[model samples]
Target: MHEIISGLLEMTGFSIVGWETILMWMIAFILLYLGTFKEYEPLLLVPIGFGVLLANLPGAGLGIVANELVMNPDGTYMTLIDIANNYGILNFLYYALIKTGFLPPIIFMGVGALTDFGPMLRNLRLAFFGGAAQIGIFSVLLGAVLVGFTLPEAASLGIIGGADGPTAIYTTIKLAPHLLGPIAIAAYSYMALVPVIIPFVAKLLVTKDEFKIHMRKMDREYPPKHEIKHMRVVKIAFPIVLGLVVAVLVPSSAPLLGMLLFGNLIKEIGPNTARLADAASGPIMNTATIFLGLTVGATMTGEVFLNLQTIGIIVGGFLAFCLSVAGGILGVKLFNKFTKKKINPLVGATGLSAVPMASRVANELALKYDKSNHILQYCMSSNVSGVIGSAVAAGVLISFLG
Candidate 1:
């Protein structure tokens, strides 16, 4: 029996070892456990875990392509070339979607469709709060550099504070494509876990008395009789203005800001093209998301993720997020001193790129203090502001990094 087992192992050529491959499988398991049990961004983490699983299986034809340098058994270079060409599906997927950088904006179109900009317009001043909140992104960027990440790698790592997955993916792929898996996983995992993460940071920034402070009623200054119609001129003009003002002024920001404005225009004026909107918001977006997550996870492949640098990114990311919460609360408190109107520090937490989730949490916390509290408006103002602030910060980073 021992001889037979040894013979079988030899026949299968099982002597070669791959520690990296084994480590990647462990990563897959951890991701799956977190997504399934802890419920940490299951939509993203679960898919990412499966991708990691797919990439690590040796001889499974998962992450391989035949070498073009080798001759075939038939003594034909063409045959070997044909086989190699046919086998690079995952590689093809990675380069086509990730390297070409088409997926993130497609995902953003879906986000824009799902988003309502009304709250942002309702309290335009709150946008400043959102902008202040993203101080974490720059802080995180500097922190990542201090931790010994290469500039491009640090740029990729720092973008996590945006609380925006698409932006994170776009920036990371451009700056350090190899780090995509850990960065994507971290970005989406934190986004999904925002409900758990932001509240703790928020609570620390304000006293219980401050947390309990009631916000003033939202003043709808636009005349009640005058409905804010989606004007065709404004719809047409806004994207063009954004493209020129932000894109031309900060050329490196063109990819993200241009596409974001493009998607918004589609939402605004493409009312006649509901199909285009649906496509952008539905299968087109979802397909891109799956591919984006899978390809990013594949990049992890054990060896890349085991580095000391990855640990530093995660640690710095969390600190950046915490400090961002502080900035938002501090900004709000400063504004309140001049305006003499209360601003809930909880709303500041949403200032990081986590968007509606942070806003919803803030609103819920307000209601906890007072059932009659209608702080959703205020929370949303900060939430949307976070979105724009993150985008602008992305532009600024691209300028320096480019």
Candidate 2:
């Protein structure tokens, strides 16, 4: 009877019961609820939530494990052969996909394939808003330093403000691998809540008049018919030229920017490679996202995630996101002060790298203030520019801080 009871307890994962494990379970459930019921980045949150649940179920051995070098009893590093012998499947996946830093760039390739750079090209000045939005990253970096975090760790934490999940993961994995889980969670969570967060901030900083401001008419409405052909030529050239320039200026950014430009080039090369572009933006991207979410969540073991520093990261990350929104809004306000052609301040809040979502939120707010307003095209310029700005910022941080 005693033996049977013990076996049952072990099999049921009850043998490892503890407050921390219970807390982690609750956290995972909350994530699941938010993902399912609230419909917030469900594709990412669901997988990550499930991974957290799997990892916390004791004795499963499905969670990640340290490489043999770190686990060796003699306090000496081990060879690849030794590490292979000790690897868990999740650990293998994590090391293979994430630690090697292969997945994020691939994800960027998909992003590039799906992106339309036309809006940005049409409105070149708005691109600067993306750079302006990055002020939050530096602000949070200083804040993290003041609150007790190493430069590398703070850099990883500060990137949560960029609202670019893959960039945050890539930067954190390079600079501060230990903080990857918290940083990724904060980045994605804030991104999922962009609709809620951006509006609140826009309302706070932007006046009713500023919200009602409209952008100049889109080129699509009043352009020479032959302009379409010229636009295609420019689109093809833009990625190639920009890629070369960025690669020259920031070598470390080459891998990510290279993949992005390559994907864009594939998209621009015409209908012959429609299948390739579709594959990049569809199956390939979805697969990468699933693995990325799972590996990231598995890293959040109760032993590592439940700590005072985790609390600090969460707080700092939220502050960074809020400040980024404010920075973008303030940037437009500053720009308007000097120019007769004023931009809608609401468009500035879309400067984070959440893409069309941020732009949509800005448009929605504008409509609420005045139904005739349609600022999505203008906001999209800033939105896409934010993607480039975040990548560049990540490169700069890695170059200086890593």
- Candidate achieving the largest lDDT: 2
How does candidate 1 score on lDDT? 0.73
Q: What TM value does model 2 have?
A: 0.93
Candidate 1 lDDT, 257-334, residue by residue in tens: 677676666777656866776777788888887887777776676666788777887787777667777788888877
lDDT of 2 by residue, 1-402 (tens): 999998988778787879988998998998899899998889888888888887787877666665443355787654445555565667767877888899999999998998999988877888999988998898999999998999999999999999888899999999998888888888888899898899888888998788877665323344323434588899999999999999999988887888888788788877988889898889999999999988888888898799998999999998889988999999999999997678898777888789889999888888898787888988999999998888899999999987
Question: Each candidate's TM vs. the true structure?
Answer: 0.86, 0.93
Task: Look at candidate 1 and give me any clashing residue pairs.
Answer: 162-353, 163-353
Scored against the true structure, residue 87 in model 2 reaches a CA lDDT of: 52
Off by over 4 Å in 2: 7-12, 67-85, 217-229
- The number of clashing residue pairs in model 1 is 2
State how far residue 259 of model 2 sits from its true place (Å).
1.4
Candidate 1 vs. true structure, TM-score: 0.86
Query: In TM-score terms, which candidate is top?
Result: 2
